[model samples]
Target: MHGYANPARFLRLAKLLTAPLLIGGGLLAVAVLAWALAAAPAERLQGDSVKILFVHVPTAWLAMGGWSAIAIASLSELVWRHPLAGVAARAVALPGAVFAALCLATGSLWGRPAWGTWWVWDGRLTSMLVLLFLYLAYIALADAATRDGQGQSRIPAIFGLVGAVNIPIIHYSVLWWNSLHQPPSITAGKSEMAAPFLIGLMASTLAFSLLFGGVVLARMRAILADTQAEARLRRRAMNAADV
Candidate 1:
């Protein structure tokens, strides 16, 4: 892991794996989407509206997964001083934010038919909304810190740690309060979701996970290139100053 932290090694590995990662990620996404949207049967109750679960549930899961990644990266940056940690954290922000937005939108769409409302101030929904805000705040803070010659600042890292505290709150929102959203349909303790629905849901989750990794890898490559360019400019400036 530490050896790969060297940018050159990391870039070399990325280049080697890029083709397979993209191909596998693309194929998995397409297969899952097709199966989820077409092959999966409609819910007995929610009918076609239940199909929204394919998108909504997966996005919600990724929203949490992305935050967890950011938190781990932030921790590594603070403790292990991993050079790529900040890059990984920053790379995940926009995609996580986008997924969070999709979760909220799809949830609202699912809610309208199932709950007779387009929006609600229920605990689960509200907490998830806060999660979305946290992602946006993390991105904004990171962006500001990186700009204006404050690139080495710890503020964004601190913000990421603090924002991670909200992840549990979001996860337990349904359990902690009498909310509009139901408990996990498939759980070790109980299972409310039918077998076919569970299959589709799991497939969707796998697809989204692959897609998220692909996006993060692509973003990390871009960040690495930018970092290298900046380093080159700094070296040139130092050499000119010496002359």
Candidate 2:
């Protein structure tokens, strides 16, 4: 991380990686989603609704994972004063919120047929909703700092750290409270899902995770470009005054 602290170094590497990550992720996502729709069999109970799992599960994972990235970046900014940390946290906020929203939307679509209603105040659902709100707060706080010309503030970082408390709650809510959501279908070393569904879902998850990384890198590069342009304009104004 410190090694790439220099914007030049980071830009060089990001430029090298950005295209591949996005292109490859896009191709893989197309393939897995196609496969899931065509090949993965319908569940006996859920029937064709199982198709939603590929998109829903991946988005759900990313919603939490994005916040995890923000929290880590926030910690870096606060503890190590990593110059890029706040920028990174900011870069991820929008995408993370997007995924969180997707998770909710997909869940509702699945629920309507599965549960006879669009939504319930199930523990998992409630916690995931809270995660979405946290994403909004972080984005607002971080954007406010940038707009204020304050060069970043501790508030966004602090909120990122504090907001992470919701992650575990989202993860464990199904277990902690009786809910419409099933128990963990997949876990470390073991999965209860049939082989084809398991494989397709994992493939979908991997593709989306790559997409998320590509997006973050792209956003970070854009932010750096904007900052550099602002600095150059400031220098030009100063030089004109000296003249």
Candidate 3:
């Protein structure tokens, strides 16, 4: 990982990997979504509403996973002082928030058909909503820190680490409280879904995860380049003043 601390090395790596990730992820996601929509059998209970699973579940996974990335990056910044740690955290915020919003939107759509309501204050939905708010807060705080020229503020990192506590609550909320949301259907070594549904879901998850990775790497490279440009401009100004 430290090998990536060198911005040049990281840029080369990001350049090499980003295209493949985007292309491959795009192809796979399209194929899986097509399959889910056109061929996958409707659930015996939920019927066509089950189709939303392909999109909703993956976005939800990415949403939580995004924060997990932020928390990990924050930890690295705080403990190991990884130079790109803040960059990684910043790269994650917008995309994570987008996915979280998508999760809520899709969940709402799914709920309207399945639960007879468009929104619910149930444990799972409520906690997931809170996760979205957390993402927004992190983005705002981190952006403010950057704009204030206090790039080294530990506030965002601290918040990232602390915000992670909500993750497990979001995961376990369905189990811990009475809710309209369904419990976990797929678990280690067993799945309640049929093979076709599982296959479609797994493919969708992999595709979106790859896309998320590509986006993060690309964002990191952009941030590094911008930072370098600013540093160069600063040095040039100082040199001119001295002359």
Cα lDDT over the full model 3? 0.92
Give the residue spans of candidate 2 off by over 4 A: none
Residues 100-135, candidate 1: write the lDDT tens digits. Answer: 999999999999999999999988898889989999
The sequence of per-residue lDDT tens digits that candidate 2 reaches over residues 1-243 is 799988899999999998998999999999998887787788999999989999999999999999999999999999999989988999999999999999999999999999999999989999999999999999899888988875667899999999999999999999999998988988898989998888898899999989999999999999999999999999999999999
C-alpha lDDT values of all predictions = 0.86, 0.93, 0.92
Error of 3 at 156 (Å): 0.4
lDDT by residue for model 3 over 207-231, one digit each (tens)? 9999999898888888888888999
lDDT score, residue 28, model 3? 95
- Model 1 TM-score, 2 decimals: 0.93
Model 2: ten consecutive residues of lowest lDDT: 146-155
Ranking by lDDT: 2, 3, 1
- Which residue ranges in model 3 land beyond 4 Å of their true spot? 150-152
Instruction: Score candidate 1 by lDDT.
Output: 0.86
TM-score against truth, every candidate: 0.93, 0.97, 0.97
